[model samples]
Target: MTTAATDLRADAEATLQRLAGSGAQLREDQWRAVEALVAHGRRALVVQRTGWGKSAVYFVATALLRARGKGPTVIVSPLLALMRNQIEAAERAGIRAVTVNSANTDDWQAVYGEVRAGEVDVLLVSPERLNNPEFRDQVLPELSRTAGLLVVDEAHCISDWGHDFRPDYRRLRTLISELPEGVPVLATTATANDRVTTDVADQLGVSGQGDGALVVRGELDRESLHLNVLSLARGADRFAWLAQHLDELPGSGIVYTLTVSAADELAAFLRERGHAVTAYTGKTDPADRERAEDDLLANRVKALVATSALGMGFDKPDLGFVVHLGAPQSPVAYYQQIGRAGRGVERAEVLLLPGPEDKDIWAYFASLAFPGEPQVRVALSVLGDAGRPLSTAALEPRVELSRGRLEMMLKVLDTDGAVKRVKGGWEATGEPWEYDGKRYLGLAKARRAEQQAMLDYITTDGCRMEFLRRQLDDPGAAPCGRCDNCTGKHYDPSVGEDVRVQAQEVLDRPGVPLAPRKQWPSGMDALEVPLKGKIKPEEAAEEGRAIGRLTDVGWGPRLRPLMRSDDLAPDAIVDAAVEVLKGWGWTERPTGIVWLPSRTRPALVESFAQRIAAIGRLPLLGALADDAPPRYSDPEDDSEPEPPNSAQRLAEVYGRLSVPVDLDPSSGPVLLVDDVSDSGWTLTVAAMLLRRAGAPAVLPLTVATTN
Candidate 1:
């Protein structure tokens, strides 16, 4: 090697020693990646295994470049948890790292000041922040101008074909295009197939050839990961099995669930079984999430019951086991999640407790995927005609999609250059756009296939590790001598009868309190609805209850198909409803019952309501979804095509429920019932009608609630 090459290697080695230890040595491939970035100023993609020192490459490069007076390294990361870990790790290596994210808004000004003053070596940003108006307009331009190195961590998200779908990642192409020339770029991910790798590299403006990134992909298999799958068809059986076997597992690790409700419910059940555990999901508060992560790292908890929110970039090297309560939809996702375990240990047990509800849960999530052409057209039309930038909430009253879905669609539109996210809100670019129906259809097909692949992982006669490796296009896919399939050492999935009984009780018992809508959705006046601000307490519904959330462990999914049946709710459901009523903390008892009009399954809802009133010996009132003509109507059009937005939907439903005009407030509170609570708007409107018709308090009860 030449003199400068030797010096670069020595500098990188010194940085690695600081990062790892006095004797820490750089791996050959790690050095090559570092050399490409620091010496040649070339783009690099590192696709190493979870513990193969992917992070070391970037940190070492950052140190070497900064020594030569390069600007601070900018890393576009996926999760706040990941950013927190990176910031901590960078500090340990003597790199002054800072983060800008939603959780640290109060610190942003200070952080930006630090960046401007050259006191920071590495800066981590969440992917969504790439287009955040404040960050994108003011802070991001400076980052682009002065960033010495650019890194996209968890780069699989940049691919259209990757297991994870994050639209904000696509904005990296624009960021890359705007970067100053010859700024070395690095992309890293523990999870990515050949397809994803190519897509990400191409998006980074690299073609994987001469003058392109050095794609350094190492072996995908981890010799320390001992894979096993325990198939328990019943939900109760799965939890019982976990309760019985959690202690026998190697060390403190993670027990991943498919839904937030499942994560919370399972964590509680595990605690009841005398295990120290906590639930982690997207719903968890930012500070609490950080605490839970720290607790796990310190071994204060046996395992964190988590959803995919805990999936990417959490650094726990000695995690002994990874247990999945329900299968993830893709084998790639399953492998990357399990990579959290066995990193710094000799052997880490990775177990899959596949439930029958896994497929249904996958289907429910799939329903939230990209919208169809008509909905996309509606949003575009609204934007094109508005002629002004509209914030997401302001646009909601004119669009049919929920807030979450609407935001996701807007991001996708922003990526395609059809719209731009500006300081005020989002502005239409007036770029001609067409929905990629074929592309979306292909994505849908790929999702179904991935779900099948996960199912196949359970029943596959081949090596479990090999099956997962092959799913990611690993050319070195081979039998792992330690897997249950290879060694014939299957786990005993048996649950004690006592454990089963206790778990079944937890499943059978259920009630979820439903909070009433206090404030009206914004931009109602723009939709020509005179309503705005908080609904008067006298005109609002009191807090209510649901038998459970639609994502609950056992009862939630079962209700959907059962709701279509003409027969009344089964005795078990009716019994649960009674329990909910008895447990409800109502200041005054409800004097009567009122059912929401169901556009679908009216007979089922009405029958359920009649049974509840008879059992409670209370009076029954009227139906609500669309039973009464809207209180407000345009004289030119007696009817409006089902109002397309929130304000429109509220206007159409407002004062429409025909409550008895003579009903007396002294008759006491009214029990408002719906078969399902989706968006909770209809329930809000119906409750307002009852309160206006002289009911002192309106309480809403639904069999299940959907997000």
Candidate 2:
């Protein structure tokens, strides 16, 4: 099995040259992985640094294997961005690569036909699609049997957090266990500690003992990465710093945020300050995300304000810098993100501006881990009693879990064989499942430890790169002589006084449009709510405004602790609400004011509305009073984000509010006030009641909204 000495070697070399240009050559480790997969048909794991030709190995091996009449290679890629890059590279190598992902749903049939007709050499599929009802029940069985080589990019994801966040990845274990003998399998990752490496290798090995796989690991260090950290006490300060110094850093890059709201907020600030930037977060539309990636790649945008959703999407070796608005929870995760930078450039600046609210964000994500045994039991029982399969949407109301947690649980359960994802949805397998309390405990502990390590990395006086490397358990972890500490060249954290003021002003600028909900929550029939599908256009509230999102940098932090405070909203809060109303730019000024009775924060809502009515000198219409509707309880964990099904919520809110008898609607649009708008259902119901009372229009104004 001397692959390098064989005639097939030329094909592999040519493939590399095609993808990486005429001078491209495979390094010894690349050939070793290629030899294992293509020549000897054995399993292997390659742990190399980013930009170390990991993709090169697989594409070259893919071309070589196809030359010998092997079936198409199926790569289980993790992100849409990663899939796009791989497909582009494969095309350059003349390897017909196609992807099956959520974004390309319309082309799935064509892609499948191509794969079956041997027109495709490489097929990339997202981990989430691994257990898609149709894909899992129909496509996977055949793909599993005929795949020539199996490649798991970002193989580190097979570990704990991956299982929790992307539970469908665990299904690969079953896929690997059932592969026909002698079929080559390769797993690759740039970020994996010893534990992760061993765990992934064990999973990759058919024997399940991990000894059957060849493990190749290289030193994890990037010379082009110049690491530095700047502590910013306030979210506004972070934005101010970026606004002031972003152009001074390097070429085009990314500015990372912990939350979607932060990304949206920061990008708006940067763009207002005359920077070409855009926000890329989990909430961004798939088509828009792709456009943002293209803009960043083309250098049309100076930076992309993004969250972790942009991770692993870059194949660009020339990305100049990466700046974090807040630290990620794990040092390895941080290292992986920063690795996206300095990949192709001689020097790319990597900066971390750790915010005070980082831990809160960390705890929020950590809380989404595997649900408690009781919740799992509820889900299982719901599926068990159902005579037919149930889709995630149909099951969400009964499971009492957020969409994220519910989908995650279903995937984990599917992987465990406790439930099966059939064509329509999931069905209970009647497989007795034991809740692994011990494993969950260990995961929790490991998460805390990793978080501590991340904090240490922030406070460390030692080399930043060395600290990250050591956290990943690299033997060669030592001072890189290039970091801020090692080079004695720290980034100046100072922001110009004027720029700082501008940033604060931007944050303080209130008035976010509260677009009225045109559609009632779907599946309301299950909750016995009369509302279904689209709301009547005439009954809908007119587009309105909120002071700001609760996630806003300036108002959000101030409003967060105030969500529970029933005391009168302070003068400053009242003043901000007035500002949003004053600047609303509405087509028709609200003729009168009406307030919603709050279950919590009654004083705040009334006081804020009273101030607005007094300031505007409008008639003070009475509240849309409620009569003890069943209220949803917050999760004991506090981080399990508010339950998300609007139908169930509508059920609790429907018919609960009544319009004031004395209110006259023919005058004009009336202002409807609330302390906060979350789900927008409460406001929707209120507006409907107001409209029913003959109001020409209802304009909703809230101090804050969760969206």
Winning model by TM-score: 1
As a TM-score, model 1 comes out at 0.95
Model 2 agreement with the true structure over 196-239: per-residue lDDT tens digits: 88777776663335445678889999999999998888877888
Tens digit per residue, CA lDDT, model 1, 28-106? 9999999999988899888888989999999999999999999999999998888888888888789999998888889
True-vs-predicted CA distance for residue 423, candidate 1, Å = 2.0
Q: What's model 2's TM-score?
A: 0.93
| True lDDT of residue 496, candidate 2 | 88
Q: Which segments of candidate 2 are over 4 A away from where they belong?
A: 1-11, 162-164, 206-211, 634-644, 660-667
Q: What are the candidates' C-alpha RMSDs?
A: 3.5, 2.7
For residue 147, give model 1's deviation from the true position in Å. Answer: 1.8
